[model samples]
Target: MDKNIIVSWMEAGMIQVPNLLMQKYKQIGLDEKELTLLLQILSFIETGNEFPTPEQLAERMTISSGECSGVLRKLVQMQFLSIEEGVSEDGIRFEKYSMSPLWIRLADELKFEKKQSDLKLTLLEEHDLYSLFEQEFGRPLSPMECENLAMWLDEDGQDPVIIKAALREAVLAGKLSFRYIDRILFNWKKNGVKTLEQARMQGIQFRQKTKQPTQPTTGTSSKTIPFYNWLEP
Candidate 1:
């Protein structure tokens, strides 16, 4: 390896992944999934010699024990680990798991993109709407919220069209709050606003009327009612 080229890549990272390392990885005994995980394991080890536990791997991949096992077996077979090593999240090498020199060297060359790609696999494979909602809300979505959201997608009765219209209204208004959607749904239900066409028409009417300023009329008909603001209450 040319020292100048090596220096250039190393400058890009605390440690750099080399094309030669990738070429060497190609000769390893592993399938695609194992290959990818191998690269990740190598990256961490290369960067810091950090070995993640199978449980952590499962969470990261959103995979089952059996699936993680299959991948782990390949790692062990390919000499990524000879023994199952256990370590807490903190950096400690309390146990020994037999791993290959190539794996170690490859790990040193690991990059963030590989780790992030593994995480993206979990996101794409899992039904994370529940967790996503929890993350946004700072609390888990309630069973009622789940049911309500589900109802929006149900194919069986209750016009899916109406639900779509409501979704569009929220999107167009740049107001995606469940509270606002709930209010729209509530008023729609009360007023028998069942179809998308009906809701859209109502939405248009609302836009038109809100854009129109209130006229100052005389007589006792004009009354400034306090406490009309929901946020104030």
Candidate 2:
């Protein structure tokens, strides 16, 4: 063998296989020949061979064309692949194969996992929020207060950050009560302050409005106007 030919062969191109597919094939009960056929299909996709016929696939493997066709039928029956007709680049209609079932299954699994993870996180957040309220109140939360918190998280659709902001506002106002916090949250919802940043901005605007001094109704003159003289009486 020519040394240059050997070097070129050694530097063969690569194809990427998703780890999910590799990890899931056994679960799908694919046998050795079926797995090899799956790999060959993947290779076809990598090399821009969108629709490899049974004969073409058999040429690349030890299987006969009839056997390759049987395997293709079995794969389609198992929902591992699908075949559709499409116009090729030369305007000739041909069969187009798709392996979307695998991706669809993977996507559903990922969504389920994400939902589970989010549920766990929400439970943790609920516990932490309860702890925070108890710490601020210097006592354990009453069952009513706990129910209110649950309602805020689940039914009221309040963000945890907004809830915390409401609590901080109540603490600053020296109210330190669930009713006060709930009132703050209600006001925030009315004002469309769903995020922490929006809550802070709303707080600043409220403070500015309250901080502005009321304009004097009386004239600048030291002599009090008769209209304002009722102040002395």
| Candidate 2 lDDT tens digits, 88-202 | 6899998777878757766666787789999998888878888999999999998999999989989999888788888887776677888778877888887788789998887
Kindly provide the TM-score of model 1 when superposed on the true structure, using C-alpha atoms: 0.30
| Highest-TM-score candidate | 2
Candidate 2: list runs displaced more than 4 Å. Answer: 1-14, 19-36, 47-78, 88-93, 216-233
| Candidate 2, position 78, lDDT | 84
**Residue 145 accuracy (lDDT) in model 1:** 78
Best by lDDT: 2
Candidate 1: segments with Cα more than 4 A from true spot: 1-145, 151-158, 216-233
Report the error of model 2 at residue 229, Å. Answer: 32
TM-score per candidate, in order? 0.30, 0.70
Clashing pairs in 2: none
